[model samples]
Target: MAPDWPAALRVYLGVIAVGNLVWEAAHLPLYTLWNTGTAQEKLFAIVHCTGGDVLIALTCLALALITVGHRDWPLRAFRAVAAVTVVLGVGYTIFSEWLNIVVRQSWAYSELMPVVPIIDTGVTPLLQWLVVPLVALWLARRTVQRNLVVTASMNR
Candidate 1:
């Protein structure tokens, strides 16, 4: 039987929200804001970025679901769904980094931030996309499976 969709979505997004928040806080020192901005501003940046990260994760997952997943997802084609999600997230992150850092000058990195060659995106944000979503998806899948097991046993 199919997994509980609503519970899975909640787990997926909850992991993304918490993971991004912690990741943002951990990596803030690598940005210019760490040194230039006040403590409150830095805190706000972390929260704001975490919110954006959750939104982006949701969008990427939705796109991946439409393109590669089915109504029976997490029970089938999970790897494909995950791969598409990661690829979409990474691609968008690169573009967003270029736009915000180079074009808009909305933010800048410090000397400590490792940047990708030519494209000039931070390694941290790129890595964040790769790591956070995969972990979130994995946990969500686990949650769904456990819920399914419990549901099946109860039904029996």
Candidate 2:
């Protein structure tokens, strides 16, 4: 049977939301200490981070689905998720770092933050794409698999 794309997408989004929240929470101190801004500014920063993370997660997921062919099985789907995360994570990190930091000067990284050797993006942001999305994708795949199992059992 064909997979339910809508249901899978919902699961993916939920996973991304939770994953992004955790990612932001983990790096909260870094951002707060680095910014030295007002409460409203901090709130905006949080919102911006969350929004951008979600966009990256969604784009990676879409690319993965396209590359590996989304399947009903969790394991199969995970291959795509993992592959795309690494590929896009590295690529986007480089491009975004160059664009935002080098070119536009939109944001500046603190000296405290560790930078990737060549790309110059912060370690946290790079890992944010690589690690967070994998976790989110895994959770989403598990959810979809569980639902499929439940539906199959119900039909039997």
**Pairs clashing in candidate 1?**
none
lDDT by residue (1-156, candidate 2, tens digit) is 555556767776777777777777676555433467777776676678788878877787677777775565344666756776668866887798679888998767766778877777788877877776667666766776777788899999
**Residue pairs in steric clash, candidate 2?**
none
Q: What tens digits encode model 1's per-residue C-alpha lDDT throughout 31-132?
A: 999999999999999999999999999999999999999787776778999999999999999999889988999999999999888778899999999999
What candidate 2 gets wrong by more than 4 Å, as runs, is 31-33, 70-77
Query: What C-alpha lDDT values do all the predictions have?
Result: 0.92, 0.71
- Per-prediction CA RMSD (Å): 1.0, 2.5
Query: What range of 10 consecutive residues in model 1 has the weakest lDDT sum?
Result: 1-10
TM-score to true structure, per model: 0.96, 0.82
